[model samples]
Target: MSLIKKTFKTIDELKKHLKTHAPTFYYSSQTSTVIPYDKIADFFKNKEMTLGDLSQLPCSMELTPTQNLIVKGAISWKDAKDFLRSKKRNIMTSPTEELALISAGAATSATGERCFHFGNLRSQIISLTYLNFDGNEVKLNQDIALKNTSNEVKKYQKDYAQYDIFKNAPFPRLETQTDLMIGTEGQLGIITEIEIKTTDDFPVNHLFILLPKWEVDSKAHLEIINKVQKFRNMVILCELIDANSFEYLPKADRPNKEMDAIFFEIKTQSFNDFYEQFVLNLEYIDQDHVFELAATKFHNIRASIPRAVFEKNSQMGVVKKGTDVQVSVSQFETLLKIYQNFTKLGIKYNLFGHFGDAHLHFNFMPLPNQVELCHEQLELLYGHVLKLNASPFAEHGIGIIKQKYIPAFWNQNTFKVFKQLKDEHDPYKQFFPQGFMSLEDHS
Candidate 1:
């Protein structure tokens, strides 16, 4: 599609623009993981669409220290962190994309490294302001306090359990309009501002534990991960760096090229506390294979893998294809077995991500000729994943690229309910015309 890109500096400007020209799509400022570039390029080639940019919306933030943060949607994660740091407070869990807009993360239900304990982006949100299809501003707030212990929230989850698409998603299900608006990928509304809960910014440290050769020592690697699983209380994030992903990292960042690694973060009050609670207690973890790094440096090293993957895809002129499925812990072993099939097919790939949550990203770096094969394999894999009742698009919301898979995920009745909800909220279908469910007449 030929996209007419426009940016608005204020909500008033956006409202004015909407009155004149209806935007068919909306995306954040950065072309980070949030944007579905391949879907837009391939699926809308013959269509002309106006793509609205929400990133330039006026920046404003109010921190209540240990309470909550009321911030404009356009505020970047880095800026939010900086502001919170000044007050000795921060979002309990933050997504890895520091440059991404916080509103984008909440809208897409993006998860952070510490998601296993603190929960995903949705957990942080207390209330949000969004513009509907008519460009009228509306705010949705949690009826009760933002706590999982609320009976209303639990009852809502139990009532809507049948319609839940992502089975293993974090708590606070579709209880209110706020829950519905989140993870809708702009299909419901354009998020303008958000109020999210915060926590004290305590100091922490990282542990990088090396593994034996992954391909040969697969059993050993799984056993190591099982060990890490027992220490969830102290560990904030338990990530896996498979051999394929390790190769893509810069030589300067890697400990060595010889082994895969299990990287995790832990609370660091003092040296003795760390040694007693984590170091000495984690059996089978040899001191020779383990080391520590500062949080900032460790994050940089971890972020490099995804950056390298995207760079390689760009260089090869191939569209990025990756899995974001999250299943129950019991099904994770099966998921790993399916990933191993990539070797049998001789497809070059990388597998890494939130090992603790049973959510991992498996990216395919196929040559032009191998793209078709990759698509076939992905379809088969997703089919298997659905059988396990996994959240097929776990961290990443279903943008245009993954919309085709929704039919299998949602029942006919559930699909109709969502369509009806969309019709009620956006009768004109002016917002995100062909997302989640296509309402446009391309013919």
Candidate 2:
């Protein structure tokens, strides 16, 4: 049967097709979770049996006159970004935006500052077309008006037993079905198509601030964060790179041996305004000192750190482990203290990420022998994140790797609601099985 035209009559049929045609869909035996299949060799090696070549999925991309892109779910993020750049337009989305959008249909990013809706991906979605668990097609309009009649309210009250859990939620407004599916991590349905808004490309002014090791823990760092927050409107991106991270960079790009750095990308139009309002007060830098670079070059330098870390781990035959933790801006100091403790423990790790949002990717490039120790440190790190009322999984959704932390992050009541939603939309758990929460027991 041609897989593209195959219409599944039952959930078992779908599972059978996936097992036969998409064997890479299963989770890793060691980790008990699914991860991205970036390398073709890894995919074949993990499956242990190659029935046939794994071909690219078919997809279509259409760009409207208004610059909106309507894309199929199978399109890779890099492809989408290339298409936008070809048209001299851009979507200020995170680096991992495409992975989540393709696999889960919804994703988050630190690039919200540049988005028209301020980083909420849902707001940029014009519509969605998906396949329900029962082999039915469903289309939802983003601007559809919802009716809240008494009967509808009663149904909601009855369906969601833990309504009280969200009673005091900051955004108390009820979410439409479209909103719910955006970040469900493919638990609800298979996203088939998406409509996304784009923005005209603009030049960005790059600024690099190198900080001494001592300032990482001092009040001076806090003052800098405060100043950045005060002028956030003018800054598009703010990232912090730890001293350890520089080890991964090329010799020419690495900073001073004892210094860490922060990279800022600000919209050039407001450069003068931001300089007068915030830059003049930055006590960390001397008044006459200034450092600048092309925005593209600055981002490339930042990207090289992770690339180097991964290459080092691959060479050592050890898996690279990392954590995406975000805490309240007020708790930045506490976050640094947690990082400091890890360093003191002799753990080999690097800290870098979107400091503008208090989210950092704590990547550990442990030697093969230090794998267990790396896991231990991750547990300790997550515990501290919870104590500070922060999220252990921020922009990255709870894929197979982070499924174990779901219970820790969400209360029983909240989890029950999640399960209920999953059950209602995907009763058999056929789509992206064990992505968010493991359904092994339930199955």
Candidate 3:
């Protein structure tokens, strides 16, 4: 089987082509996804399907007086950010990948630094237009939620009121049809345009705080984290780098290679008051360790760790294996303990990510022979986290690699709703046929 690549410059052209030859997989910049290359190649190995390149689509943006941004799906986060910056505005939250398209973010329900405050891409989307399975255009927005009169929706609301697909959402909310396209891993449709809410660009300070690993100094480390949490109102982003992950950090940035790090940002509108009260008053926090850098510089240093690990895995011919689990604030410490205890499995690993959201990435760097063992350990870990009521796949939606874990995440009742949604939106199963959930995994 061969994969044919097709590029579409306009929505009309895409819709026309889709009517005759529907694309099975879509590729834009492909810079942000963790889906393995082998998985994709293997998936298309036996099928003849066109791979649509959406990167060439219109990259336009229009900001309304009410701060709503109408953007074409092809625009990248970097371009969108630059456009927003010129207007002295910013999106609520975005992933770190600059080349990754904003539409990909919405499709994957992406989240990043400010997610703990504002929420994921799903929360920012006010409206969207997408091509359905039949090449027919469908538009959905907030207004549709009010006008929804379907019996299926009513039953879904009545039956699954207690269930939440995204467990870490700031608050519980009912699901609407519009929400289906946001995070179904591109299974439902192909998004062409989106309207997202934007916020004012506020000034902030980025700080990297070094602390001894919990195994080395638990009491002192816990105290520092507690102090940082006290100013939750002012702190926007708080991420961690465990001791094992320090090896991935650039040598110049690894001031204390043996110690862990917490990189956070403080809203600087009232910097003087916070500096005097927080930094000056704290004797435990080393003034020397609290280094301030520009937002870009800080993010680069933080991002370098994960990028290095990814490259290293590729070099070693091992598929990337990692967790995107997020638990309740109360269970966060327990999750940390479980991750740290994973070392007993004798597999090398690194842990880092959004500490504020109680979400962290625990990546396993396994040898070729250790891949099976690593997977067995991961299944056990998933089961344990499920017992703790954790979001097995948070922030990042369940792509191909994470599909096998869906059985553990969803029960029979919830699974039925998922299948029903799939049947309604993509009855032919043409879009990313192997992305999120498989038909056989339902039971």
| Winner by TM-score | 3
lDDT of 3 by residue, 36-140 (tens): 754566667778777787889977899999998889868988888889989999887767666788888777777887775666667678898889877888888
lDDT on C-alpha atoms for all candidate structures: 0.72, 0.58, 0.73
- Candidate 2 Cα errors over 4 Å, as ranges: 1-55, 96-117, 144-174, 214-218, 255-258, 287-289, 439-443
Q: In candidate 3, which residue pairs get closer than 3 Å at backbone N, Cα or C atoms, i.e. clash? A: none
lDDT ranking from best to worst? 3, 1, 2
Best by lDDT: 3
Between 1 and 3, whose TM-score is larger? 3
Worst lDDT run of 10 residues, candidate 3, spans 165-174
Which pairs clash in the backbone of model 1? 1-44, 1-45
- Sorting all predicted structures by TM-score, with the top scorer first, yields 3, 1, 2
Q: Model 2 over residues 1-443: C-alpha lDDT tens digits?
A: 11122444443454455444331232211111124333434433533332221113356788898788888735655677778888898765545233333324342212222331135566677777766655466787778743342344335434334322211111111355455456555556656677878777776798877676632454555677767876666787777787788877777876544476777778789888878787777776654434677866776777677667766866876656777766667888888787777776565788887776666777777778888888888888877866766666655556555665455544444444556666666666555544553333331
TM-score, candidate number 3: 0.90
